[model samples]
Target: MGGSATRSAAREVILTLVVAAILIAAMPLLIGTYTLTVLVIYGMLGLSLGLIWGFGGILCFGQAAFFGLGAYIYAISAVNIGESTLPMILAVLLTAGFALLLGAMMFYGRLTDVYLGVITLVVTLILFKFINSTAGPQYVIGEARLGGFNGIPGFQTLNVPGDPGAYIWGDALYYVCAVALVIVFLLVTWLLRSSFGRIAVGIRENETRMALMGYDVAARKTVLFAIGAAIAGLAGALFASWAEIVTPTLFSLGQSAEIIIWCIVGGLGTRLGPVVGAAGLAYLEFVLGQQSMIDNTLIMGLVLVIFVLFLPRGLVPAIASLWQGSVGAFGRRRPVRRMRRARHG
Candidate 1:
């Protein structure tokens, strides 16, 4: 039974990869570069949140904190360094380190889920306000000034790893973002199939039980949180490069809420659900923002409510469940038909 289950999981993994490949191949042909770039960033943010909240059972409401931190770090460092390579690395590490510290404080305190969520939200808000107030020249970090609400602009954009002269932008930037998405997706998929991933999920499902089973629950959760933060940071770094600016708005409550909404609407606990949700909703938002006929917020809220009421399991998971049910029904019918033939013979 264990071997059979393992084989089934392997098959699912291969199937997922094939589907991803097909979708990615079709993206450039279907979507314009600008929209695709935004979608890619949103997808990465969703993926990061999905990993922690869905798989690790961490309800982080301040995910945008890490996202903004990464963007700011990248922008500042890139401005000073005259290239993106080192700054990109710095962003990921700094964000992950911050997550580690934050996670340790909460996990070690044994904070309830409610408290955890509140703390995260508060943290995000604090960052937003603090960054917004840093408009004075005294708020400078080396060559990069914290322009407060105005944001830091004219920073160095991303270039190739070795050759700083080969700036990545336009169509090339779009493809880079697409490729990054694929790599991160595959990496997370692989992680989910590993022992650490299984243990993390176990911790999520039952922390006490995992502790009794000799696992360091707090440490594991901290690690998972750090990983998620790192992914968000990567997304933020990319966003900074794409926009050539890092703003306090990146840490705004709306940004954090949108990340959660994307995860919930996409399908909590599923690998690709959040990505799908983020991309789909971001495109919808883009379209809605372009027109002045309707109240976009009202429409979005109504849509979210409808999804929560009608499709609680989310789009991807609901479709997956239906597909599995049909397959199961067909398999059962095949066995019954075989039995009938044998009896008749």
Candidate 2:
């Protein structure tokens, strides 16, 4: 039964990826490349938080810290090294390392969940303030200067592997972001099907029970947190490439809050919920941005409230429930119809 379940999960992931590939190929025809690209990056960012918070039950309020770190790290490194390949790698690894350190401190210290959230939020605020304060001319890292509120721009963006001069932008960058998001989605799905992932879920469900069952819950949580950070870092790197800039606003409280909202609005425990939430809400925000008649934050707050009160399971799970109910009703009606025909005959 276990093996069968694993196989089923694997098949589901494969099918999902195939569908994602089709959408990636088709979406460009329907939406502007720039809009789609930003949505893809945001979707990836949402997935990172969803994985750790939804599956591992680690509610990190500072995910944007990792995201901002990734962008800044990549920008700084790319500027110094004059190539993007190594900088992107550094962005992911260094961000993950930072998360691991922070996670270890929080988990092993036996901090309460509330405190964990507070600490993460505080850390992000600190980064935001510190980055903004670096406007002075002396604030320099190698060839790159921390431009403070102005942000770091004009850095080398993503390039084809083994060729630094072959810059990827516009449609190529959009495709790259879409493909990367899909790959991360697949990897996260596979991780959730693995033993470690199962253990992490169990820990999320009942931490005390898992601890009693000889699992090192702290270590597992720390590792999961780091993995999530790594993913956010990758998304940040992609965003940096697309925008060609890195700024302190990336670590702002608003950015962190937006990520949580995405996961909540999408569906907490499901894999696709975060992506759907991120893309849908982001597109909504984009549309709202073009109009001055409505306040974006007010609109988002209202949406969050509505979901929390009415559609608590989020859009995906709510839609899934409706679909299942309709299918079941149809099946039941078919059997009744067959019975009636037999009786009539």
Model 1: how far is 36 from its true place, Å? Answer: 0.2
- Model 2 regions more than 4 Å off: 329-345
Per-residue lDDT of 176-250 in model 1, one digit per residue for the tens? 888888888878877877778878878877889999999999998999999999999999999999988888999
Q: Name the best candidate (by TM-score).
A: 2
Backbone clash count, each prediction separately? 0, 0
Model 2 pairs in collision: none
Over the full model, what C-alpha lDDT does candidate 2 score relative to the true structure? Answer: 0.90
TM-score for each prediction? 0.91, 0.94
TM-score, prediction 2: 0.94
Q: Where does candidate 1 clash, by residue pair?
A: none
Please, what are the lDDT tens digits per residue for candidate 2 over residues 206-251? Answer: 8999999999999999999999999999999999999988989999
Kindly report the root-mean-square deviation of model 1 from the true structure over all alpha carbons.
6.1
Q: Which TM-score value belongs to model 1?
A: 0.91
Candidate 2 lDDT trough over 10 residues, lowest sum: 336-345
Best by lDDT: 2
